[model samples]
Target: MASFSEREQAFENKFKHDAELRFKIIMRRNKLVGLWAAGLLGHTGDKAEEYAKSAVESDFEKPGHDDVIAKLMADFQAAKQEMSEHRLLKQMEEMLDEAQRQITAE
Candidate 1:
């Protein structure tokens, strides 16, 4: 039997672990989406990877995912690519699932 303090500590550890995992999943999703967008914008190889990193960094600008979406929207518009916010959001959702699966598998 664990003491109360031990149980509390275990719970805290689990919470921290879950938070870290969630962050990783979100970042991975951002990278995946960035790659997808990069392809549409005519970036390839190292440029694509750099764009993906920028996508991950964009999330740090604000608390939620809006900053990322804004960046992507601006980029698409600048490149004269046709992309709707709805479609981009749907892509984010799909990428999120892929990110989770990838993280869990590793």
Candidate 2:
């Protein structure tokens, strides 16, 4: 049987792992979506990387990915790029899986 301290340590370890995983997943997802949006907006090379970082930063504007989506949608519209919200949502879902796989592999 584990003592109280041992059980507490195990719980702390699990919490830390979970938090780190969540952070990695969100960051990876943001990078993937940023790259996709950059491509749509004709950004390449360093410009695309900068845009990707912006995407990651946008996520901090609010809870969840609402801010990111809003920013991308507005940018698309402003750039006269035609992209349905549904398509963006789909890409987000796909990117999430890719992000999970990427973090798992790292």
Candidate 3:
């Protein structure tokens, strides 16, 4: 049987792994959403990739996903794109599921 310390260590490792996975999923979701937004904003190829990177980085500015939403909304407005916040939120949710699937497949 495993000792207490071993069990504790296992739990800690699991927690760390879960946190890392969560971070990866969130970043992937941001990238996916960013790419979607980039396409809508007339960006393509390298520009779209760069925009996706910017969206991933925006998550670091805040604890939650608000920063990302704000950035995307501002960009949409600046580009004269018509995107509703509700639609954006729905897309985010869908992208999150896709992110999780991609990560788990790897």
Q: Lowest summed-lDDT stretch of 10 residues in model 3?
A: 1-10
Off-target runs (Cα >4 Å) in candidate 2 are: none
Against the true structure, what is each candidate's TM-score? 0.97, 0.94, 0.97
Candidates in order: C-alpha RMSD to true structure:
1.2, 1.3, 1.2
What is the RMSD of candidate 3?
1.2
Give per-residue lDDT, candidate 2, residue 6. 98
Once model 3 is optimally superposed onto the true structure by TM-score, how far is the C-alpha of residue 55 displaced, in angstroms? 0.5
Q: Which lDDT tens digits does candidate 3 get at residues 75-99? A: 9999889999999999999999999
Candidate 2 lDDT over 22-104, as tens digits, reads 99998899999999999999999999999999999999999999999999999999999999989999999999999999999
Clashing pairs in 2: none
State each model's CA lDDT, in order.
0.97, 0.95, 0.98
RMSD of 2: 1.3
The number of clashing residue pairs in model 1 is 0
